[model samples]
Target: MNEPLIEKTSGWRGTRELWIQAAYGALLETGIDAVKVMPLAERMGLSRTSFYGHFSDRKDLLDALIQLWQSKNTGNLIRRTEAYAETITEAILNVFDLWLLPDLFDSRLEFAVRNWAHSDARLAAMLEEADIIRVEALQSMFERFGYDTVHASVRANTVYQTQIGYISMKKDGPSDPLAPRLERMRTYAEIFAGQPVTDAEAARFFARHPVNET
Candidate 1:
């Protein structure tokens, strides 16, 4: 969780990034309704008027948060799909790194923005675009591995939708054992890539994402 942003009662109006951080933290921790100016200003220990120095209004701040979500979550996922890999299975594992590596994609922000998109039509469209972009990237990944377009499309959607559904359901646990999950990832690779995940490929994947080593 982000600590409350501090601003003195004097002329220190606070930076735009500071206000954006507070707003983002609020949106992720609470819900979109809690991202109003007064609540964020009160939470940040700042005056309501000070927020205008950074953004025109709460809507502006929300816009920034949406952009932030796109850059951090969707952008990273696309990059992961484009990463270097020698085989289709390895390429699939490369994309899986986004789920295992915390510094890559912001799952919390993804979840929050997805929930926020439910009532906002503009955001809903944006979310759909991002999802299409992501799935296209995955589809290209399969295509690069010599799969035909139709087969690639089906497999990519399967991989992308399965992960998105997992994220939406929020079934993550920090203290869960890693070994079984590792095996699950292997099975996932075989299913999605339509090929076996070799021991070496699994070893290399885990090497890059050893959040909890054996």
Candidate 2:
């Protein structure tokens, strides 16, 4: 008896989403070396022919994953920071907290990406552009808080770098839990903005700690 191939209803968008999700999952579980087209195709329960219909090669899949990441996380960060004009500082802190908290993505995924970036030019460029967008978003928030462009830019870079450093350090060795650090960063940001920190404000600081620790 011949079984029919069940057509996927997800169309191109669904197939692309599955590809990106699978790539991210594979990278997180086994690093970049494990993300070959054959393995990915197997994982997706699709034939090489079907996979080829979506991506030209492994590099193409990686490129698509990078675009998806930027579109979802980096793009949303920019939009949320801009849209929350009134509470710019709090909004910015919220964005940072999302990344810093546990269980969102294994911190190891970030570590792996950083190392992969060293050898892969395209990934490196994407990382650089993402950082620039983050800094720019922070600068805009600072300006809304009444800081001049120069000061705002500097502060933005400082905060942005501090986060990278914090994540890198956590990846390297022992450190405080992400929740406490996030709260501390929020308090510092409030003081940096020359505003009094309210308990309500501090409460938003530790809100997003994912319980499923990776």
Candidate 3:
């Protein structure tokens, strides 16, 4: 039986989060087409008693998924770019934290959404809007460092699109080792921010994100 999110007194229909999680799993594993409510209920071991007490329809679930993506992925990225930092490199490193923390930016969901957009004009438009919002946030970060609007736009596009491309190509692939990846981040910061990462700056980041190195 699907455990009720509430106490024993609650209904057995399962919480909205359960359905959304199952929908995300299905979308990531198979494709968007597999995210119907009945199959999700079956996968969740729920009774499938027309028990959609949360979302009214499959489209409702899908909208929930997209809203979650918007909040986690794009919302976090914007907040990162806006986070307090002493230098452009530090600012960019703040943005880079998303690459490490899936809680901040779920790359698998992002990839699936991008692929889904190919056949979804509405989603494709939303994607373009999201890209604009993301790049503009990066641009604003650059502007804080005294870059001209043109330079900021170019650099922001470079950083944002490069990461998007990386997500698309990195599907289901193991990431490169952390130590080497950390080393390359120094170079990446300089390239993206047009500023070198100081040893102190790099040390702060490395210390914050420790590698087991075992």
The global C-alpha lDDT for each of the candidates, from Candidate 1 onward, is: 0.86, 0.67, 0.85
Instruction: Report the number of the highest-lDDT candidate.
Output: 1
Of candidate 1, the 10-residue stretch with the lowest lDDT total is 171-180
lDDT of 2 by residue, 65-183 (tens): 66656665566667656755346567666655546543333355556677678889878997888889878987888888788999889888877686678567764222456545555
* lDDT string, candidate 1, 74-171, tens digits: 88989988999999999999988887666787787888999999999999999999999999999999999999999999999999899888789875
Model 3 lDDT per residue over 1-214, tens place:
4443233233567778877888898899998999887777677767566446887777788899999999999999999999999999999988988887788899999999999899889999998999999999999999999999999999999988888888999932236577777787778999998778999999988987788878
Instruction: Supply the TM-score for candidate 2.
Output: 0.73
Model 1 lDDT on a 0 to 1 scale:
0.86
**TM-score for every candidate vs. truth?**
0.92, 0.73, 0.92
Question: Which prediction has more favorable TM-score, 1 or 2?
Answer: 1
Off by more than 4 A, model 1: 1-4, 7-9, 173-176, 211-214
TM-score of 3: 0.92
